[model samples]
Target: MFTGIVEELGSVVAVEDRGLDARVRVRGPLVTSDAHLGDSIAVDGVCLTVAELPGDGTFAADVMPESLRRTALGALRAGVPVNLERALAVGGRYGGHVVQGHVDGVGTILRRTPGERWDEVEIGLPATLARYVAEKGAIAVSGVSLTVTHVSDDAFGVSLIPTTLAHTTLGGLVVGDAVNLEVDVLAKYAERLLGAVAR
Candidate 1:
C-alpha cells in the first residue's frame, strides 16, 4: 500500500523486453536508498516489486503483459519521468489518501487552463470508472494524490499548485498525454454495497 505521495521524480533509464514480460530500470536515488529485493515500489501509481536493487541509485522491476496493457507504463521511453513512492510503513502518516498503488485505468489529459497561482487540468475519464469519481474526491493520477476540482460525465479537473507542478511528473504532462488513474477505494466499496443492498 501507498499514500499516493510522490517521493521522487524518477527517470526511466532502460526498458528490456522479454517476450511476455518486460524489465524496467528506473533511477530514483531517494526511493532506492533503502530499497531491497522484493520490496514494493509505486511507479506511476502501479505497485511493482523490486526484482533487483543495484547500489547505483537504480532498481529493476518486471512488468507483466497484463499490467502493461492496462497502464501507461508500456508507452514509457528512455528519459521519461515518472512519479515514484515507497510502500507505506505499518504506522506511517497518511499524508495523502489510502492508495493501493493499483491503477484502475488510464486517462488522457484533455486540456489545461492556467490560473494565476495554479493550473486546472481537465482529464478524460473512462466510462467504466466514471461512476466512482466525485467532485472534491481524491484521485491518484500517475501516483500523485490530487483532489477533484470538478467532474463531468466524461471528464474531471484538478487544480495543481506550483509545488505539485514542480515536484511531480505531472509537471511535464502535455495535452493528450496518457496518465494512470486510481479512484478512491472507499467510493468503489460504497457503490458495490449500495448496489447489492438495492437488489
Candidate 2:
C-alpha cells in the first residue's frame, strides 16, 4: 500500500520491450535507498515490483501486458519523468490518501487553467470510473494524490500548487495526454458493500 506521496521525481532510464512484456529501469535514488529486491514501488501510480537493483540509484521492474494495456506506463520511454513512491512503511505517516498504485482506468487531460500560483486541470474520466469520483475526494493521478476540486459526469478538476507544479511530472503535462487514475477506494468499497446488501 502507498499514500500517494511522491518521494522522488525520477526519470525513465530505459525501456526494454520483450513482445508483450516490458522491463523498465528508473532512476530514483530516494525510493531505492532502502529498497530490496521484490519490494513494491509506485512508478507513476502503478504498483511495480522491484525486480533488480542495479546499485546505480536505479531499479528495474517488469510490466506485464495487462498493465500496459490498462495504464499509461506502456507509453513511457527514456527521459520521461515519473513520480516515484515507495510503499508505506509500517507506522509511517499517512501524508496522502490511500493509493494502491493500481490504476483503475486511464484518463485524458482535457484542459488546463493557469492561475497566479496554481493551475487547475480538468481530466476526462472514463464512464465506468466516474461514479467513484466525488468533489473533495482523494484521487491518484499518475501516483500523485490530489483532491478533486470539482466534478462532472465526464470530468474532474484539480488544482496544482506551485510545489506540485515544480516537483511532479504533472507540471509538464499537456492536453491530450493520458494519465493513470485511481479514484477514491473507499467509494468503490462502499458501492460494493451497498450492492451486496441490496442483492
Candidate 3:
C-alpha cells in the first residue's frame, strides 16, 4: 500500500522486452537509496515489485503484460519521467490518501485551463470507472493524489497548484495524453457494503 505521495520524479533509463513481460530500469536515487530486492515501489501508480536492486540508485522491475494493458506504463519509453513512491511503512503518516498503487483504468487529458496560481485539467473518464469518482473526492492520476474539482457524466477536472506542477510529471501532461487513474478505495468499499445491506 502507498499514500499516493510522490517521493521522486524518476526517469525510465531502459526497457527490455521479454515476450510477455518487460524489465524496466528506473533511476530514482531517493526511492532506491535504501531499497532492497522484493521491495514494492509505486511507478506511475502501479505497484511493482523490485526484481533487482543494484545499490547504484537504480532499480529494475518486471512489468507483466496485464499491467501494461491496464496502465500507461506499456507505452513508456526511455527518458520518460514517472512518479515514484516507496511503499508506506507501518504506522507511517498517511500524507495523501490510502492508495493501493493499483491502476483501475486509464484516462485521457481533454483540456487544460490555466489559472493565475493553478491550472485546471479536465480529463475524460472511462464509463466503467465513472461511478467511482465524485466531486471533491480523491483520485490518483499518474501516481499523484489530486482532488476532483468537478465531475460530469463522462469526465472530471482537477486543479493543480504550482508545487504539484513542479514536482510531478503531471505538469508536463498535454491534451490527449494518457494517464493512469485510481479511484479512492474507500469509496469502492463503501459502495460494496451498501449494496450488500440493500440486498
Candidate 4:
C-alpha cells in the first residue's frame, strides 16, 4: 500500500527488453537509500518489486507484460522522470488517500488550461472507469494523488498546484501523454457492498 505521496522524482536509467518482460532501472537516491532486494516500490503508481539494487542509487524492477499493457511503464525509456514512493510503513502518516498502486486504466491527456498558480489538466477517462470517479473525489494520476475538480462522461480534470507542477511528472505531460489512473478504492468497495445488499 502507498499514500500517493511522492518521495522523489526519479529518472529511468535503462530499460532492457527481455521479450515478454522489461527490466527497468530507475535512479532514486532517496527511495533506494534504504531499499533492499524484493522490496516494493511505487514507480509512477505501479507497484513493482525491486529485483536488484545496483548500488548506484538505482533499483531494478521487472515490468511484466501485463503491467506494460495496463500502465504507462511500457513507454518508459531512459531519462524519463517518474514519481517514486516507498511503500507505506506501518503506522506511517497517511498524507494522501489510499493508493494501491494498481492502476485501473490508462488515460490520455486531453488538454491543459494554465492558471496563475495552477493548471487544470483534463484527462480522457476510460468508459469502464468513469463510474468510479466523482467530482471532488480522490484520484491518482501517475501516482500523484489529486482531487477531481471536474468530471464528465468521458473525461476528468485535476488541478496541479505550483508545488505539484514542479515536483511530479505531470507538469511535463503533453496533450497525448498517457497516464495511469487509480480511482478511490473505498468507492469500489462501497459499490460492491451495495450490489451484494441489493442482490
- Positional deviation of residue 22's Cα in model 3 after best superposition, in angstroms: 1.1
Per-residue lDDT tens digits for candidate 3, residues 27-66, read 9999998888999999999999999888888999999998
Model 2, span 58-120: residue lDDT tens: 999999998999999999999999999999999999999999988999999999999999999
lDDT of 4: 0.94
- The Cα local distance difference test for each model comes to 0.93, 0.95, 0.93, 0.94
1-199: candidate 4 lDDT, tens digit per residue: 9988888999999999999889999999999999999899999999999999978999999998999999989899999999999999999999999999999989999999999999999999899999999999999999999999989999999999998999999989999999999999999999999999999
Off by over 4 Å in 4: none
Go through the candidates in order and give the clash count of each. Answer: 0, 0, 0, 0
Output the number of the lDDT-best candidate. 2
Sorted on lDDT, best first, the list reads: 2, 4, 3, 1
Please give the RMSD of candidate 4 to the true structure.
0.9
Evaluate model 4: give its TM-score.
Answer: 0.97
Top TM-score hit? 2
Question: Which regions of candidate 1 deviate over 4 angstroms?
Answer: none
In order of appearance, the predictions have TM-scores of 0.97, 0.98, 0.97, 0.97
Q: What is the lDDT of candidate 3?
A: 0.93
- Cα misplacement distance, residue 24 of candidate 2 (Å): 0.4
